[model samples]
Target chain A: MKFCSVCSSEVKQRIPHGDNRLRFVCTTCETIHYENPKMVVGCLPEWQDKVLLCKRAIEPQYGKWTLPAGFMENAETTEQGALRETWEEAGARVEISHLFTLYNLPYISQVYLMFRAKLLDLNFSAGEESLEVRLFSEDEIPWDEIAFLTIEKTLRQYFEDRRKGHFEFHIGDVERRVK
Target chain B: MKFCSVCSSEVKQRIPHGDNRLRFVCTTCETIHYENPKMVVGCLPEWQDKVLLCKRAIEPQYGKWTLPAGFMENAETTEQGALRETWEEAGARVEISHLFTLYNLPYISQVYLMFRAKLLDLNFSAGEESLEVRLFSEDEIPWDEIAFLTIEKTLRQYFEDRRKGHFEFHIGDVERRVK
Candidate 1:
């Protein structure tokens, strides 16, 4: 940050008293601006043997296929955020089952929380942030064209767990990028 | 936020185009400052049949007892953040086992990720942000003097799960207060 959001004064990167890491400290007000990782909540909406996917209509991988997800907002639970994203991105209603994946992407400062959910009905369409939305069975999934590694990993694990006749929570870190 | 950290200009809250919720948008620079929930990483540090707790020396519950936790910083994983907090608050090294509880405090825009951990050695003391640190068995816990509801709930669940002989991951929301 170039300036302090609280006082609008210039900021310097320095470790504060009793802290180990460097933070943006304001010159005038001495306010420290701390940035933390964000939670990206989404769901793997399922119907019969298929899962819902949205084609992104925005930048940073536009037109790529991804599970319905987005940055979680305030005043909502993670499951609620996942449901909202599913409804908003794919216009689909889903009944959330359980949290399936907790992938920490330290490089991007994001934690992806994906849930296993059942689609309520066939009444679905592409929302504002999606160019198209469709349901694909395991055999029909466009695995080669998936949007992100986290999504790919979650999808793979979901199918594997399904074949095993039991579902379990999975947690791991993703270090795909160095920066 | 009153001013934009990017350009040091005044920010106004408005619903940006294509977004349902209002955001702090910079009028002069047209920058949208999105605020998301942050992760508070901590651990239930165990030594034999007892768990460690810290008495806060900081504001917002100065003398109340709590598990060692703080906001997850950049360039670190959730587990790392929890370990760092444990070492910093209790001056104890711990071996984290598995994530035990994921509590969403939506009212305060924070998510608490507590892990199950084992104390490495007997060399432990209170850190700067803690007035005192002590180990307590389940029956010896100070149930009335707990600092936060989430911490209390986590501790209760941990003991219950232990009694049941099966520990499972927990995810829930806490709406104690509003901003």
Candidate 2:
């Protein structure tokens, strides 16, 4: 940050007292501007032997198949965020079962929290952020055209856990490879 | 936020196009500064049957005991953030087992991600943000003096799960009452 939002004074990057990392500290108010990782909440909305997927209408892999998800908003639980995202992107209402995957993408300072959910009905359509919305079975999934790695991993684990007859929570890091 | 962090221009609260909530939107730069819930990552550091706790030296609940936790920083996994908070607040090293609790405090726009962890050794003391650091058994816990509701809930769940001979992930909300 070039200027402090609090005082409109020029800020400098420095380690604050008792802190180990450098942060944007205001020159006038001396307030430390801290940036934390944001959570991207979504759900795997499943019906009888099929899961819901949405085609992105926006940039960053537009038109690719993805689970209905988005950056979480304030004053809501993670499950609420997931349900909201699903409804916003796919016009689907789902009952969340449990958190399925927690993927940390440090490269983008974002954490993806995907929950297992039950699709209420088939009354689904493409929302504003989606070009198309549909259901996909195991063999019908667009394996080659998935949107993100986190989605791909969550889907794979879902099928695997279904086969094992036991679902478990997963937490892992997905780092961008240096070129 | 009074000024747009992007352009340093005065911002006004407005609902952006295709969105439902009011956000700080910059008229000059057309930047929508959206605020979201942040994650507080920490762990229940266990050395055998005892768990580590830190007496806060910082404001919110100064001198009261709590688990070592802070805001999850950018470019770090939740587990890494939890471990770092443990090391920084209690000067303890721990190996994380699994995520134990996910508590949503909607009033404050924060999510607590607490994990079950194994303490590495007995060489630990109070860090910069802590007044005192020590281990406590279930019977010796300062139940009435815990710093936050989330911490107390996690500790209570931990002991209950331990007694049941099974540790499971917990997800719930802790709402703040209006005065």
Best by TM-score: 2
Query: What digit string (tens of lDDT, one per residue) describes model 2 on residues B1-179?
Result: 78877777888999999998999988798888889889999989999889999999999989999999999999999998999999999999999998999999988889999999999999999999999999998999999899999999999999999999999999999977332
**Candidate 1 structure quality by residue, lDDT tens digits, A49-93:** 999999999987798899999999988889889999999999999
Whole-model Cα lDDT of every candidate shown, in order:
0.93, 0.92
DockQ score of the complex predicted as candidate 1: 0.84
Candidate 1: segments with Cα more than 4 A from true spot? A177-179, B177-179
lDDT of 1 at A67: 98
Residue B65 in model 2: lDDT: 97
Q: For all candidates listed, what's the TM-score of chain B alone?
A: 0.95, 0.97
Candidate 1, CAPRI quality class derived from DockQ = high
Q: For model 2, what is the C-alpha lDDT against the true structure?
A: 0.92
Model 2: docking quality category: medium
Instruction: Identify the leading candidate in terms of DockQ.
Output: 1
Q: Candidate 2 at residue A174, lDDT? A: 82
